[model samples]
Target: IHWHMNISNQINYVAADEKRQIIPYIHVKDMQGRVTEYFAKDSPLTPDQIAKAPRHRMDCVDCHNRPTHIYVPPDLAVDQSLLARRLDATLPFLKQQAVTALTGKYETGDEAMQGIAKTISEFYESKYPEIGKTKQLEIRNAVDELQRIYRSTTFPEMKLDWKTHPNNIGHFYFNGCFRCHDGQHVSPEGKVVRKDCDICHTVLGQQEGAVSMASISGTTFQHPVDLGDLSAVNCSDCHTGGTGP
Candidate 1:
């Protein structure tokens, strides 16, 4: 069980005068009855104040509302397609081009499909004419796959995509844990739900390497890019999809 917007052990509602309309404090209870809570450092309310607000237990739908209707981000789709050889990664800027084509602002789904097909075809035709001619079949396959990706992930009529319905599984590209673990939810006693990374998961050899006991026992999280201690900042602050921050 996971919980957000924890007011307190007793009170659940507090005055909404803070800058952020909703400051969520992340809470998780495991099968063994172990419960852990994280507070955002930016919370306006003090520990005493937060101790008065009400807390609601979170359900599956709170985080995974789109379980069946999952929408993949364009970048992820491109990567998967490349991995599966549907899109030729050898093409100079295949990833960049594919993402650009898929993420285009089309008024309708048909327009988007056409735009994607045209974009891929035109890019290969103009940039790599020889390879384009030789690998026309591959190019055609790529175009079909890219169009398929767009169709599965986006709904122009509903304005739905990864951005519209931010995934909550992790904190890289969307709101997710940050929606509650931002360290803003405070208690009346002035204590906040600390957003310590280790509170949720232990770092166990993150890179592509063999695992060791030392790493399993205790390993600090290493940010991909050097950002001195993300104690207060959130991932969505910089990583808004596409190329990472």
Candidate 2:
């Protein structure tokens, strides 16, 4: 028998002083037609209550919620531009500067455009005057790209951005797969919603600078910055869709 489930929404009923909680639940039927229900380890709902509670079958929209309108985060957007050579990697601290410019506070789209221009231009001109003069074209291109990124990802009118909506594809910037597979959800039989990295996808290869590693089977997932055991927290706890933790 096979079963797949995820908690899409939760009832919000917490006092300001109380800590918020979620009680994810799942029901599965075996090949023999026997049905079993499982709730998170600390779920307060009884079997009768769980049976009566509304349930939604897993669907594409549940995972692919932002399929059409994806508000790309500044850091991810900058990394992508660098990878594509849209923003010249040879420019010193281009990624850092671009992300900094993009994440700056701005009230309107026009302000964002002006802010991006000023931030990138001022940064290069002040820090490395020679490079700023010689690499004017590259710097301009990077500024334009960063502004474009800002226009697409940020919307001050709607108060919407990458951080506003949690992308359900990966667990890096948002709680994605870790929403259920956080190891906190457990069944009565003691079966956990496995938080193992390899459970869903395999890391075929990893590359950093000039160093590259690959394997046909899979490679162990490594954190870019060592923060000790990541099992205790979600990636979204640190990565807030901006620059850094």
Candidate 3:
């Protein structure tokens, strides 16, 4: 079975008028002597032109490229830790401090482990003395979790980390889907690949602080920070899998 079947239900089909461009397709003759024209809704390529063009058979790995060897970024790692209660969210500045410690330059794995522990411990000890003293266990647990996260995602010996590899899964930390659907790949007829957010999946709900927003229909994405004209920019332009954007 094809992978598209798995996510077919999630695909939000755009109206005919809203579609900016159609995917490039061609006519091919199979070994069974059947001639099939794999064309899009409004593609303008002639049969002769398409026959002369290159052909690529789509496969799972073409999109799902990083099934293993996954490197989680510091910010995302910290968020996962907080969600799973591995890191104490009650500790103020825990996310900020953890990411800082992880993103800091270190020569070796041992140095990174030591640096992460020291960074988290010292931050709480100096900034929030009361919490540091009273919640010593929480701080220690957070430090331990952070160190584990650092060890798993980062390898100073090989000079490798999340940033070293591009995980083409989503358009959050890297230009995953946007590489093809960035509204720039135009055909001769001026049709594009279509960069609409709802083309793939629907964002059912979003939460900001105490307020939560939801819709039966998908809602437009809201960036955490107020950066103007996000549509014009790729996510990877700003999100560099680091401590700061």
Candidate 4:
């Protein structure tokens, strides 16, 4: 299957009487010529008629921008390792120290790998010498795992990290859905593509466990931080992956 869009120069020709620009919709197709297309709510074609006149043809990578080569962020890697018991959380400050070690600046991938090993080994050996002595093998295994994580997720030669390539599955970290769903796309008739969040997802109760079905059904998300209202916000506007706190 393919997912593509129409981005011809003509699409950018500015129309008067609008504060925002309009762009074409995303299109999808399979090898057998079967096609599925997504359009702004304001699209002229009705639902029954859109497939015959898709705006573009698309492939796997249009949304899955990175397929094989994925760089996991240092924080996420540490969290996953701790969850999987690959890195012991009983060790004080392991998560914080691991992230710091991985994200440290280095001249090359080899240098980064060596530095990761050295930094982590030195940290445990110096600060918690008794634990280091008793759990030498476990400590060594952790160093190896962290080194592996860093080597796999980072390419200092290319200066690539999570920020360079975006995962389009969610709105956070990058402008995934907002690339088209910002509600700016409008038809000549002045109708707009709805940017309602519920169109994509409904909030199940967050941060609470063992809730009843009634609690999960109608509860809306409450942003931990007060951002006034979310109508004007896109998650990518603030969540810049590793670049952010």
| Order of candidate numbers by lDDT, starting with the best | 2, 3, 1, 4
**Better candidate by TM-score, 1 or 2:** 2
Tell me how far the alpha carbon of residue 74 in candidate 2 is from the true structure, in angstroms, after superposition. Answer: 1.2
Give candidate 3 regions above 4 Å deviation.
1-56, 205-213
> Compared with the true structure, what per-residue lDDT tens digits does model 2 show for residues 1-245?
01343233221111111111243676555456555555666566666676666665555554577877888888989989889889999888887888889888888889999999999999899999999999999999998999889888999877887777667777888776676678877666787777877887699999877988788999988878887777877888888767677
**What C-alpha lDDT does candidate 2 achieve relative to the native structure?**
0.74
Q: Which candidate leads the pack in lDDT? A: 2
Model 2 segments more than 4 A misplaced: 1-23, 42-52, 205-215
Candidate 4 accuracy as lDDT: 0.64
1-245, model 3: which lDDT tens digit per residue? Answer: 24332433212211112121233453334445554443444436565665565554444654577789888988898989899999888999899899999999999999998999999999989999999899999999998998899889999999899877677677888776665567654544555566777777689889999988898787887888887766678887877766666
lDDT of 3: 0.72
The weakest ten consecutive residues by lDDT in model 3 span 9-18
Tens digits of lDDT, candidate 1, 103-144:
889999999989988998899899899988998888888888
lDDT of 4 at 220: 64
For each candidate in turn, the TM-score is 0.72, 0.80, 0.73, 0.63
lDDT of each: 0.70, 0.74, 0.72, 0.64
Q: Which candidate is the best by TM-score?
A: 2
Off by over 4 Å in 4: 1-61, 125-134, 183-196, 208-216, 231-233
